[model samples]
Target: MAKFQSLKEAVAENLRDGDTVAFEGFTHLIPHAAAHEAIRQGIKDLTLIRMTPDIIYDQMIGMGLAKKVVFSYAGNPGVGLLRRMRDAIENGWPRAIETEEHSHAAMANAYEAGAAGLPCAIFRGYRGAGLREVNPNIRSVTCPFTGEELAAVPAHRPDVAFIHAQKANRRGDVLIEGIVGVQKEAVLASKRSVVTVEEIVDDFDDLHPNLCILPHWTVTSIVEVPGGAHPSYTHGYYDRDNAAYLEWDRVSADRDLFTAWMKENVLDAGPEIFAARVKEL
Candidate 1:
């Protein structure tokens, strides 16, 4: 069952060094606050997983928390390159990190396979993509029935998964009402899971049929963190903090500026700060 806890306690108890972790969200409901909590707690050597890695991952990498990043596309959204990610990969600023790149389809399939308790994900992809050459994990399998070739990759089973959602009811069930990404599959595929939400409501009284809900049994902990996804909007709560995303391009370009910004804004900040950030955004 999901225990309501502080972000600090949840990360401290459930996450560990050298664990494979996935902080998943698409353009919406990204768990920026939970990621910051992990950073604040000084978690290290994590094998981070995501689909399209953005600013939050960049910050984590710059802080030297991640040893490996498994992802498909990596950028700062509408902005330019993720400078911190590039610095680590190219200049090895904090530390040298490893990467396992894949296509979007492959990653989605891998997560689904992991959620289904399968060993690997088989799909038709990498036909013309160069990801196979860069990643040895991309292998080919023969279809038993048709004798056709197919692509295969290892299942993405993480030790822990972090996500942000719109709400969790008193029963601890999470409701995601926005643009749903691979958050559901990522949580189901993990050994443990943590969720940060906008509010804990009495019930999901007027939820639409298309919204996704994870039963309490599936989550390890839930942290009530408003604006948990700042810069990445939650469906019903707020708009995307576009200026922050744009400013990241400049702040992240300079090492000293990046460190100072993190120390003041993220490292020293807490849940109340996160709530205020939402209001300001």
Candidate 2:
């Protein structure tokens, strides 16, 4: 069994330059805060893989912490284009591998294929769509059984999968409420997996059995840190700071402002210090 003394140690020890890392979360829930800390600590040349990346990916790419990014969508909720990510792609800042998905189901379908140890997965529902034209990486394959061409997305198996859960035990048994679709696939497809939880339980039995998403045996490391998902929120703990996200979206448009923000919030602050700052916010 792998043991981690703390969240910081786990992030520092496991994350390295040039590794392909996946973050498990939706629009704004249970982000890989510890992994972001690793990025802030000068872990460079990382290839970030995700279904839909938001501010986290934008921040990393803007700060030059990532070398490449593989994802479907990236932007703020209502603020048009993601400033940093758009600028990066427009100016050819970092190596970008873009993919497109018309809906949540399509993205989930791709991850399902990845988890199932298949080279690709096909869906005939979204045929001759704009998403297919935009993403050249996704190929169209003819179905062997039906002889129909459908969109086939290649498998994505990352080097590491990082996730933040609502609760877990010392042994890394995770419990997350609601959807567990892509998270489950990402964890299964990765070579190494790390989980950070808002609260730690003494035993797996402490959590309702149905709510448990990941077992201890599947997780390589477990870290306990309350309020770990700052910009992102744990389900029942707190709500997302919409004002802060808006502020981030506005300021991050300028490169200088983005750099300054990262230095102040991420680079200069450790886990404890960062949590303290969030409390002030």
Candidate 3:
């Protein structure tokens, strides 16, 4: 069952060095505060997993928190490149991290397969793709019904997964309303999970049946962290911080500039800063 805890306590207890972790959101509800907390606690050598890795993963890579990254697409959303991730790969700034790339379809299937406790995910893909040549994890499988060939990748069962949501009830059920991704599968596939929410209420009322709501049993911890998804907007709380994204393009371009920004904005900042930053928005 889920335990209500501080982000610090939750991260410290659940995440560890060399563990495989996934911080997931589609375009919204990105778990920035939890990632920042992981960085602040100096968790290292993680095998980070995400379908679309944006700025939070970039920051994690810049901070040398990852030894490898498994993802489909990685960038700064509308912005160009994840400069820090590129530096790690090209220049070995922190360290040259290993990458296992896959297509968006394959990643989504893999998460579902993991949630089902399958050994591997078999999907029809990589027909004309070059990714199979580079990513050794992608292999070919033969179908029984026909002689058709299919793509196969190992299931993505992370050690821990993190997600941000609109709210949770007193029972610790997380409610995600907008732009749902593979977060539900990612959490179900992981050994442990953490959720940061805008608030916790007595009950989850008038919830849509189709929306994602993770039961308390599936989540390891729930942290009440309003504005935790900042830079990436929550559904109804605030708009996406396009200015912050633009500023990151500048701050992350140079090594020294990025380091300074992290020191002031992330490393030195506390959890309250997240709510404060959101309030300012």
- Winner by TM-score between candidate 2 and candidate 1: 1
Off by over 4 Å in 3: none
lDDT per residue, candidate 3, 63-157, as tens digits? 99999999999888898999999999999988889999999999999999999999999999999899989999999999999989999999999
Full-model lDDT for every candidate: 0.93, 0.72, 0.93
What TM-score does candidate 1 reach? 0.98
- Candidate 3, 40: how far from true, in Å? 0.6
Per-residue CA lDDT of model 1 for 164-268, tens digit only, reads: 998999989999876999999999999999999999999877778667999999999999998889879988789999999999999999999999999999888
Candidate 2 residues 26-89, lDDT tens each? Answer: 7545564675677667788888877777888787777777777777667676555778888777
Off by over 4 Å in 2: 93-106, 277-281
TM-score of each: 0.98, 0.88, 0.98
Considering summed lDDT, which 10 consecutive residues are worst modelled in model 1?
Answer: 272-281
Pairs with backbone N, CA or C atoms under 3 Å apart (clashes), candidate 2? none
Clashing pairs in 3: none
C-alpha lDDT of candidate 2 relative to the true structure = 0.72
- Comparing 2 with 3 on lDDT, the higher-scoring candidate is 3
Q: Tell me how many residue pairs clash in candidate 1.
A: 0
* TM-score of candidate 3 against the unseen true structure: 0.98
